[model samples]
Target: SSPLPTTVFEDEATAAQKAIDALKAQGIQRIVLLSHIGYSNDKSIAAKLTDVDVIVGGDSHTLLGDFSAYGITSSGSYPTMAKNKDGDTVCIVQASEYSKAMGELTVNFNAKQSVDSCSGKEHLLLGETFTRKDAAGKTVTLAGADLDEVKAIIAKDAQLWSLKPDASAEAVLQGYAGKVDALKKEVIGTASDLLCLERIPGMGYSKTPGCAEATRAHGGDISNLVAFAFRDMSITSEIAIQNAGGVRIDVPAGDVTIGTAYTLLPFANSLFELDMTGTEIKAVLEEAVEYAVKSGGSTGAYPYAAGLRWTVDLSKPAGSRFSNLEFKGKKDSAWTPLDMGRTYKVVTNSFLAVTGGDGYVTFKKVNDAGRGLDTYLDYAQSFVDYTKKTKVLNRLPVSEYSTQAIYDKNGLLQQ
Candidate 1:
């Protein structure tokens, strides 16, 4: 008999102004609106709204500080200034993402309750410097002054943190800690062999653990396991391909625990299904191999499919890289040549299948065309479910996969 509350609004500006008016009606003179709609949206809001004095914004993960000496790029200056509708200044600031820095702003108001001057610094947070590789995998040293400032901040934080602990919160955390300790030791699955997940730096290929034989195995043992888990969880798709980078680490031979699975496949990528034609599938593989060849075999676009296999010749040109493609619907089914005209139901992680992650452009295109469907299954949970259902995990050796070779100039297989 009653209409629903106006809880869901269409426009962000309308919702924001409504809240601003409500607060102003309550005798609030100055407003510092904290927002996550990103830097550009903050500017738009400040331009239209004269009531807001300051906006601390985020979500774009824009770095607004001078971090060049510390090897960080800044999008703009800290405390970026904006002009409001009433010709007043509105201060907007955003700290960078990944908890790497803190933005501090101080404002001084004039006699008329307007900000006279504002200044702040984005403090670069750091930990004890260790020998670490840069993004290009080159060894680099942290700046001495930055390192010293980090150490000082660490010491000061330690002193402040040691001053007091909330008794109730500490007790709650301790109870959770005890449960976590037990969960860490609880065995969830068992592995009979060591899964070699050693990947060549910049190259997606990997070698068997403690063995000399190397292969361009995109999924490797661990990633194959993850892909298999995706296929097992999907109701409409028989094939599952996960990005090689999604598999984080190697799983050792022993009992598998909750912690073990978490370390191996940590990210919360959801499973997505795609209704794709075999022609598009071939194109996706070609893009991956082309990326690898173009990047000197340094890309993670390599595919690791659960129900499909194909041959890749690195010596060949881009579109001709893949051949002898086959798909097996069931574990006991015979492998059949993939029909280029037939549409197949495929499954992959949300990152690669939906966002074209790791250069899966074909998948993203199909998804954007409304052919992709979200299964809403968490990747790690699928692995957990597979482990529980199967009860045993085994290392998939190179012998288990279809033949893959690199051709030399003379059309001969290279060693």
Candidate 2:
């Protein structure tokens, strides 16, 4: 979220224009904007600006180069060119997220100081060491001829880099290495059953075996668990909603650790409590479902919740896709029909509550209306705390799943 007041902050395009005007007044025409707005916004801004020649972007974690040899997917071509207002080229480039790769771009300016050409590749940085799972399903580091062959293959790929860590940087990291390692290994709880991670029911996106089957009837197990954690940790929230993508990984049945909790909920998100009417709750769920399924938007928009349940039918049109909405308050003994006129306190992550991230427009509206409060409870840490409190983590019962039933476009039950 922007720290600057709304009255003080200018939109990206407007700010860029002002900066460009100042630069042009100084006889500078070749302007490059370092942007973190995102790929879509970068393209939009590029189309609006006539003087900006290049946009190096992040925030969307878009992979913009071919990485097929390494079995990685590319979002689009590197240096994606967009036409400015004057029809001049604007080069946009971004490497993938989490420091996995770096974008190397070369931009050429014409005599008029306009963008003439741009080219680059996203270089995937890697250590010299390589490991692979053997036939016994054990991870083993590659060595000897195998290691040599792996290095040879990496050397052949332009995007793949087999570089050694800088000694100075390694030395700096070494000071905190033990602490980091210990924190990662710190035990938090135990999972009695594998908590499967799935974005949408029956999508079969999980890498875990039988995960698709496990989640086909219900939604993501871990996502629902995260929602439960939020609601449980909150003092005033009646229900908690979590995006499917917010919870990252499958939790295999075993000892759960701080590393597992962090890996599962990796983002630096906090909890927020929102006062929303039941009508608003249903509206947000419909919005998320419409975005996730019918609209062909990111499946990550799919929602899982605690203290709320609904049946979704993809065969139905938007605004009518969800039905049988129900809610169970923290003190309620049984599930009851959601009263659209009644307002309820809902707990959600900062991403949804603050920025309305993942197409949750209703949340943004509620927040804008000053009906939300930031709990400042770290989302990942909430899971760690809940795990520590509960000691035994298990998948929520089917009845407790936010998505009670889901039907595909053909009206066939997905479960």
Which candidate has the highest lDDT of all? 2
**TM-score per candidate, in order?**
0.74, 0.71
Error of 2 at 399 (Å): 2.5
Clashes of each: 0, 0
Best by TM-score: 1
Clashing pairs in 2: none
> Model 2, 9-52: lDDT tens per residue?
57889888898899899998788899989999999999888788
Give me the displacement of residue 1 in model 1, in angstroms: 38
Q: Which stretches in model 1 have alpha-carbon errors above 4 Å?
A: 1-29, 37-51, 60-78, 96-114, 119-171, 198-219, 292-298, 397-403, 406-415
Model 2 TM: 0.71
Q: In candidate 1, what are the lDDT values of residues 1-415, reduced to their tens digit?
A: 1111333545766777788899989988788889989998988988887677889999999888766665667888888998777778788999888976778899887776667777887765554563557899998876687566655655654211112356899999999999988987778889888775633222434444442243333335676677777888897787787666677776778998888877888887889899999999899878865665465553556677777877767667778877889887856457888899999999998888766867788988998788888877888878888898888898664533533444543565544
Clashes of 1: 0
